[model samples]
Target: MGDVGSVGLGSLGHPLLGAVVSLASGGGVLLSGRLSLATHEWLADHAVHGVMLLPGTAFVELVVRAGDQVGCGRVEELVIEAPLIVPEKGGVHLQVEVGEADASGFREVSVYSREEADGDGAAWVRHAHGVLGSAVPSSETQYDFGVWPPVGAELVDVSGEYVRAAENGLEYGPVFQGLRRAWRRDGEVFAEVGLPEGERERAGQFGLHPALFDAALHALGVSGALAGGSGSLLPFSWRGFALEAVGATSLRVRLASVGAGSDAVSVLVGDESGRGVASVESLVLRPVDADQLNAVGGAARDGLFRVEWVDAPGAVAAGGEVASRTEVVRVVSEGPDVVGEVYGRVLEVLERVRAWVADEDLAGERLVVVTRGAVDAGDGVEDMAGAAVWGLVRSAQSENPGRLVLVDTDDVEGVGGVLPGVLALGEEQVVVRSGVVRVPRLGRVRVSGEVSGGFGSGAVLVTGGTGVLGGVVSRHLVVRHGVSRLVLLSRRGAEAEGAAELRAELEGAGAEVVIAACDAADGEALAGVLSGLPEGFALSGVVHAAGVLDDGLLTSLTRERVEPVLRAKVDAAWNLHELTAGMDLSAFVLFSSATGVLGGAGQSNYAAANVFLDGLASWRRAQGCRVCRWRGVCGPRPVA
Candidate 1:
């Protein structure tokens, strides 16, 4: 990065990163390359929620590579736009475009990717963008250390940090485990993370080595643990982030609390010379799990929700450690009564999260709504509303990686103790009862065991029957399950485009099919439909297969996006629950998805809605009511 007055586009010859196509200088450079699992298979190891994605660090590597060609010596700032999902077959075409230097002699850099299309043309999408500048500090803002290991600083043991991180799916190899020494001075953290002798010499080749850079963040973990941070923490965004030097074997990292009102920390990195090497105005960490990262494509199930439940022998979470950097808010009160009130509180809490994430970045944080007198209360409004929370937060967690730690506890002291481990574990939820932290797991127990003889002329009500999955189910019920009488309920029942075709298909299977257009979310309308069922066609089986997908990342989601999804899943389920409770139905099957059991990214609101159904099923079972659980998946045709 020092005076590279003229380094033309020579062959990159990087074995893993691929070759650079060109590097022309207009005080900057533009290069193109082809990437694939064949060339960068190691990258597949870096995944979130079981998805093989391009890591955020890879973007930083591009900026460093760009700075090495230009005279610029550092990456001033970088912001990730969208994630790049590596394809299973074809390669991804990449472009690194650097613009001419600006007023302050800083060049803008961008990284773009377009997956090899199977049919239609695919446009280039920018994944990450940032700025590159000179290595010298524009203004020297000196920081006084006074002396090494300042007085009153607590010496924290960071020896086993990486191993624990690996257990939680971080899997930082030896190359990235850069913590050498650390100390907690007052509320500020001071640490040194040095690279191994083997990696130091190569540091001069690039503006900054990702290994060294990543290691520097180890202090943040220790600092977070000291301050009450738990679980796996991922960097969500960078603010005024800048690198001041080209090569540094070790960094003196200093992190101090921003203020009492915020969970952020101001980060300052210095070299052995005591000069600034890098500075981050503020940094935020979010709680994450394996399931939150991998919902893209069809490979979301099977491996996504791989959970391990650990039973603690002690009452309190050992030492009850938490990351000083993480934002943990404890909702100590018994929550509101109505579902509307709960949702209002949800929006209010989300607003606070939005502010913490601020700008375009997804916030990395945690919320613990601990209630003491709710459990075993037999489906009270407070408990039911709280059950809805598990779904809502789990869905949000999927969209925003490492962003939540949900804990329900009756024990008051267990609150602080379980946080560190829960935050560290990144499991969607854990309940602290009987002096143990119980991590929950989603398992598929076959609800339909050998469909015992047909419906025996009893009429079956199928909600969302006009939809693709519903039509298929209706036909299946008639042909295979011996269901002779069918009542299909959909918002656009007979008026839907494919409604007649579906009815014909079901009727062809030798069953009497009745179509009704009803909004299941409206209890009154639903009750009216149930009461007016054709005489002699008694409602025996109820299959609630209704749902809608209005997708958005948690960062972009709001009440507008969440309500429609909830009405179909949560509210509609509630209506069905109330209306059908008195009836002696053979099956009360609720059509659920992997997202409901395993929260998927971009379906935060949907996930929450589906989870409510699951909770309702359990609640009904506890009340001695018969509730059936049947799940099926259906794919759609390509949009014209």
Candidate 2:
């Protein structure tokens, strides 16, 4: 061994790794590279909840490549510790450390990275740790994808796999969409995965491109194995993995369950001509929820979004009023600042929508619901009660599509100049500020670092505190956010399934847990529970997580079916807001849903209920009240 700097670095022919060097120390090696969304654009395609991540397969590729550099062609074992997050800007400096080989010819290997902007002195976070073994034995099972699609295998539909993946927040862009075709045969699945011509041309730079390898796993989904119909699954651990060849542009894969009733699968990989490329004896995949990914992403998770008012040019009508087909219904605040009046006002707007849509004479006309300062509009809200109407109507707009529009104004007199023009433009939502017509658009919140939590040292109230979602939120608040006291409110309360266990768990974590039988939707019941807070514990926060689901298409839905869902959310939220309005609370959190933000086909009622929470949050924030709303994570639907 000579001076470390005197050792020349060598290439592993891997696109992700810059160079590999034989350490001056006995049998050691170091692999270095840099990763960024700009350079590795394909990484951006594999985003979970808007946070781009280096696919697990890429780590496998890096491990295999580093192993090959040291005459160790097999990845004996590998475990992913944390996600390798690629931020929106800047790159991460990566290092693959392969330790000195042992007497049995096995070596320790690990992958670590740090933000390039953090400079060299910054702490390096290890993403993966594994072991490398001697060269793969040549006598291993060989596969030549000779017959193509395999004889007697039934073709599996892969067209909608990516679509379904997107619905679960596993958004795969074109580069990562490599599942070309798949087949099933006698409890085993086979697939042919290939990269696009552009990506294929770059395949020579790596052992096997991650996109191609990941697509091979998509075949399991077609056969109801592993991550079938539950949630997105990511590779957690690998055992006895071996790679014989490099630069595979396309892969022919065979996946079989490790044993009966087992979620682990054994994978065999080969080239199109049937030459062995890689093999995994047992690969265990674990379910990954958005929260886990969001924690890794930190503030990078779906960056904050605000309603931006972009100028809606050409939205002025000729002489202020010209469209005869457009009808405007102005909704004024029901009364002077009342806590529960917003729910009644929203109900009135809902009925008006029902009547307008049901009327044959008005079938061709677009009903625009206008309000004064109902939306923040880059300013504060003046009409809090009228704000709930926006949420109700957005659902109506979703269910009725093209039949309704929403408009909010700061000044009634100023709106007259742009109202007709804005209506003529047929935008779904519009805001008129000082007579300047503008439409709302969503822009990503530029995040710099971690956003601090506002949890205080007082009892936090969770309305639906015993449901599946409520339980998850309660535990999360205690474990992650450090809320020391909680008042769990539900109709069944302690009688609710797992309520006792959940209370015990929270209490064990040093939290004061109060489980009370109270219907959050019932104002008197909620009031009783809130007023009965334990001695020495004052209210510090409110989390309205209570809701019931009565999912049905718009045609099959009725006001009766919708009201229960609304009572649990809309009514409960109103009760909580009113009861806690004067209290100096630190956090007023609302559990909403993506369906509310973006309507679901069979969840109009649920969507309406959750959207009301969204509107309520905005309204509360406008009133100098501390409020935070999560539109998807803690809703009726499983957090994506």
Best by lDDT: 2
| Candidate 2 runs further than 4 Å off | 1-82, 85-306, 314-320, 337-340, 413-416, 552-559, 600-608, 631-640
For candidate 2, the TM-score is 0.55
Q: Rate the local accuracy (lDDT) of all candidates.
A: 0.64, 0.75
lDDT of 2 by residue, 75-154 (tens): 87787767888888999988998989888899988898878876666556777777889875684445556667789999
Per-residue lDDT tens digits for candidate 1, residues 317-394, read 455667775655544335443456445545655665555555444345454545442332232223555555555566
Residue-pair clashes, model 1: 19
- Winning candidate number (TM-score): 2
Model 1 misplaced stretches (Cα beyond 4 Å): 1-326, 330-338, 359-382, 412-414, 421-428, 440-457, 630-640
Would you estimate the TM-scores of all the predictions?
0.46, 0.55
